[model samples]
Target chain A: MDNENRIIITVLGKDKVGIIAGVTAVLAEANANILDISQTVLQEFLTMILVVDLSECKIEFDELCERLNEAGKKIGVQINAQHESVFKYMHRI
Target chain B: MPITIHPDEILETIRMVELENLDIRTITMGISLRDCADSDGKKIADKVYDKITTKARRLVSVGEEIQRELGLPIINKRISVTPVSLIGGLKSEEDFYQVAKSLDKAAKEVGVDFLGGFSALVHKGITPEEENLMAVIPGALADTERVCSSVNVASTKAGINMDAVLTMGKAIKEAARLTQDQDSIACAKLVVFCNVPEDNPFMAGAFHGVGEPDTVINIGVSGPGVVLNAVKKHPDVDFGTLAEIVKKTAFKITRMGELVGRVASRKLNVPFGIVDLSLAPTPAAGDSVAEILEAFGLERCGTHGTTAALALLNDAVKKGGSMASSYVGGLSGAFIPVSEDAGMIRAVEEGALTIEKLEAMTCVCSVGLDMIAVPGDTPEETIAAIIADEMAIGMINNKTTAVRIIPAWGKKAGDHVYFGGLLGSAPVMDLNKYGSKKFVSRGGRIPAPIQALTN
Candidate 1:
């Protein structure tokens, strides 16, 4: 996978129904493909990490982030989308 | 399957950024102004302005873009130029002031927070042009915003230049007096140095050296809060284990600096210079070097064993940071500025820290006696003596040291001078009443120490 086009999206907040649905809806609208997802609920809090492919996204990276953030806010969660390289560079070395 | 990164690692990174205040302190673009020199001071000023504006035009935007994309905070985007004194042919003090104005204008136009290198390297002796540049430093810094100045008055090889030291003392006093209404803020933008590093990305000490490339990008990483949290996590660990933990945390923080420097270098098409592995602290709560020291079981920073604790932390940070980056330059250790760290301020306020103790800590710390405020009535000769002491430390130990002391006009010990923001506020600490007039008045070079002969 092209590292530059891969983004790790983290959604964290209180556990609620449709949290994933709301977040994926924004990504779907932007044509972003969810490559992998691992989610868990511990102590009534939801922690979701998604590896998304933005190579085919139809919007700018910033716009995608904003849309995801807005969707997360509406769904009562906080979303952060960061380049995968930041993670790789910090952890792998 | 997508590249599998443990969820724990992802969460840890998030925690460092969100909860621990781990962030890149600065992305400084160093632009050499050797080519900007001209026989005419005005022409030189124009050339310097045009070059800086053109070179660093995209610095702030690129920094912002990277910040958003990485979801990390890059606190400052700054520029460092070659020392203005090196750009010869500027005769009068007014000519140097015009050049300083141009540098300030360029910094504003390019949107950088501060531009350094209105400096002179008089480690051994002062030149005619360099002297003129030093003379104008007070007025230049007071008249302009975002123009930082530094004067290197001593080095291990050339020993201490008492003449330059005394000159800088007067200049600092004048800078304070000129901006007294603003809490003597102009003095905060000036630094006096011994064994100064040319590629330091932090200000008010950063400057492009003659040996550097035409332009380059250097990164200064800051994560004292992150280190403090790591220390807090393992309260029962032994000293060896504690050092290991701090080193590991420093490695991770410096890795972020390396990545940011590489990304910004590629985006800006400038050569990657270095990643300064300094655990720079801010005035923000929980983000302090003193807090880290206190976490090491010290009752407070500047108490007994404080210097030893700082030595361990500073060494561990360097060890971890050097392994994480290809190039580690600048003052790559912990910065313990009084006003800039909340815990340091608290320590001073509670009488746990003193200027004398800070001077001792500087022997092991990265820089020396930074951002300390003294009484307004403190004599210039005393200031020169303090700087001389710091220079002597740097000379004998072969490390970089600096003095950024502010003698706040009309403010006495226990009074506060508030510059706000990153400059922070400092309580004026009492100084030794004894005068150094007799010692500093007999001014001459202190001569190279035995350590200087490395052959």
Candidate 2:
């Protein structure tokens, strides 16, 4: 998978067990490669951000976003997937 | 190396777009038509059309592609050419009409919503060609679907050309009469300027100056809602802290604009012009400049302290925007067009805002008397007087200002005129009933002010 096709998946909501498992399960089924992962919790509120390579994903980008959003809803969290360019332009020069 | 992405910054940007109405207001391509000039008006018209379409062919498609790829909401893609009066040696109104038609057609071909530079800069005096163009403005505007026209009759160095001011007042009235059925929407496409900017991406005042490159891309950024939301978060802070917050928010917004300008410039192979950081508003509720002023503790936009609040906002925006982009030009400040801003319209409807207060507010802001609707029966001399007053403000203060008042045909004070889309609707605002015929009729150039002798 080419590096330029990398996408950012953010999961933000209440902290709970198996939240990572629930999110990775969706990524694995969609054939997305998780290149890096970060998670932090504050006062029982969880925030997890994953950098994933979607170049080899079986599902289309929009479909993958919807699937991840649906999975997050089932797990009692809010999730979003957006192109890495959105981050690069906003954060970097 | 893998790029490091910050989750908070990404979320903030997404929230600004999805919730706060942050978007690129326009990406205007400034195309020079100097090379297209000819002794024959008809031949000149053909060259103008060819130059615009050939230079701006990819503007819209490229804008759409960037919007989709970067997840940015680019609201408008437009073109600004060299002011038509500078091209084509024309002798009559019909010749100017042909040029307007050609520009309108080329804009349609390129899919741009509005094409500016159907303009004349008679700040000092008008040439015969400029006078003919002025004579045809009424027909040119009423005939074209997407052409925007402006006449700069004043500047700090040139003072105010009262003759041109008087002419424009009559021209505006005729334009209103011709488009009476559309509630005088033709006047909405016209602007009168004092010290107008060459690289302004927003219309109906954009025109490529004679000094600009053959082609360049200028960007106008809009995010009044984002600034309002940022201010809302620090409600308990003092004025100094509030100013800092506004500056930081403006920094983020200008960064987005610069990024878009860089990308579009690279794609179009045109030099990147300045990023205009004007907080332009729309009829949309969350997107308003007046609301930002109201957020600054003004009970209403036109009440006492409105000028001070607006002055703070304008200064902070320029400070932050200038830091974000080295090429910042154009009128980079808060715009207070009544019809286009929901909060300003409400203020006017509630008798909280008036033309007098708006004039005072313009003393500190970017543009003046923008998108205001006046009574149908307002005398042309009175309209000219209003313009002369605003132009005097620009000339004296050494700032850019403009007037775009619409005399909604057959409508009086308290009656509403709808222009649809981005122009929004406006209640025909009340004007001073006092006569200014004698003042406007005294037509001659007001000499350049003492400030002009900077040399």
Candidate 3:
């Protein structure tokens, strides 16, 4: 219970430079460790999905999501951060 | 890297919630008030208030907690109690009014939007006290803000009570008159049912039946928008493919309701009831059930193939929702409440949908003729006849059906009545000018159909 802090972040918009660097900088600042990452570009639009562990985040979960969203806005992408359980429960079974 | 989750699924759910207005409509707690009955009406009302307040005191807080923790919106927290008519101690309209007030006060104290079960089950026969209670429904509803009332006047097993239907029509008109300044909003809070479910968690028809447990939790799922989104993805697909998509979408939405119901039940220490898989619509764009029908390529909702399309949609929803949860009950189909659906309002305005068309649609869908508005000059007999027709559909088909029509006072066909927020606005639809006074006045019973002979 003390260590399980999985979260999923998805970034979607037009593909551009430094999209990875921009998102990870805010995550690193929030002390969130990226565990899994997948990125694909389809017809000039970028879709980046990341699974991160936020057990040791420097900020609250809600605040971390807001900060990541703000960082994504700076790069002209839409970022959505959600607790991993939302996906696990919905997708797994 | 092991891909533990599919990005598409996650993104789809997030998109549905953030953009398409997907939500859990209501989490209702059913509390049996059978124990609150007393020889004295005042004492019974007091007991009813005490029991409901104590049992449901934490309902709103618990609902808010679940919403915040899951990051899923639960639109309402509500309570339903045992049918007031069955609590036989009350012998007069004043007693019924006292009980209605108690229910209203309890709802406000618990911070819920609505409370149901100011009801009477008169499908078979209307007792003296039940008749008296029926006489008071209009006053009761007019006196309380959040109190919802329902009457069961017909069922497959017991046939249609035309007498009670006539009474209900009169009562509805009275309620409309009582709230005429508010555009007959009180009539909007009253529902007439045939084969009403004991575990329905939706209003204005929910009530804790005698068979239900002392206290239980039930959830109603909301996702007309999510299903519409899925349908929009395959606009050109054949009907078979479209049905598959709706089934899959309904499966996912019902699962969310099941999870929320279980979690809410555990948190409140109440046994979990059923998840109602009704595609309830709101006035918001992209959230209308009619839009879902239109997604199937109908020029508008009330075209010739509307019933066929709705039948498929309703069946697919039940099939998918049943698989998602062991318990699926209530009115588990798409709801066609015109005032509550933006697409429907537009359809009616454009002459694509009508009260007659809606009545035909009800034979294949869930609730019947819901949230409709008729001209103020419409007679009580006409309303009773409409209710009778809807009830007959439910009885013969052996399905649940209800009518919640508001005869908007001083408003005629094409005129609009706005109730605002969730209840939304209504464009007074035209009713047949021809009268059904004689037909409705023949008030014995439309004897139970042959479908009830299965035993």
TM-scores of the models, in the order given: 0.99, 0.91, 0.92
Question: Which prediction has more favorable DockQ, 1 or 2?
Answer: 1
TM-score for the A chain of candidate 1: 0.96
Model 1: per-residue lDDT, tens digit, B219-268? 99999999999999999999999999999999999999999999999999
Residue pairs clashing, model 1: none
DockQ values for all predictions? Answer: 0.79, 0.36, 0.37
Candidate 2 C-alpha lDDT tens digits along B267-345:
8899999999898998998798888888889898889999999999989988887888869988899999999999999
RMSD vs true structure, all candidates? 1.3, 3.4, 2.9
In model 2 chain B, where is the ten-residue run with the lowest total lDDT? Answer: B1-10
- Candidate 1 Cα errors over 4 Å, as ranges: B452-455
Question: Candidate 2, which segments miss by more than 4 Å at Cα?
Answer: A1-33, A38-48, A53-85, B1-3, B452-455
Per-residue CA lDDT of model 3 for B32-61, tens digit only, reads 998887889889988998999999988999
How does candidate 3 score on lDDT?
A: 0.90
Model 3 CAPRI quality: acceptable
TM-score of chain B of each: 0.99, 0.98, 0.98
Q: Write the per-residue lDDT of candidate 1 for residues A1-93, one digit (tens) a residue.
A: 327999999999999889988999999999999999999899999999999999999999999998988898799899999999888888886
Worst 10 residues of 3 chain A by lDDT: A1-10
Question: Model 2 clash tally?
Answer: 0
- Report the Cα lDDT for residue B71, model 3: 68
* Best of the candidates, lDDT: 1
What TM-scores result for chain A when each predicted structure is judged separately against the true chain A? 0.96, 0.94, 0.93
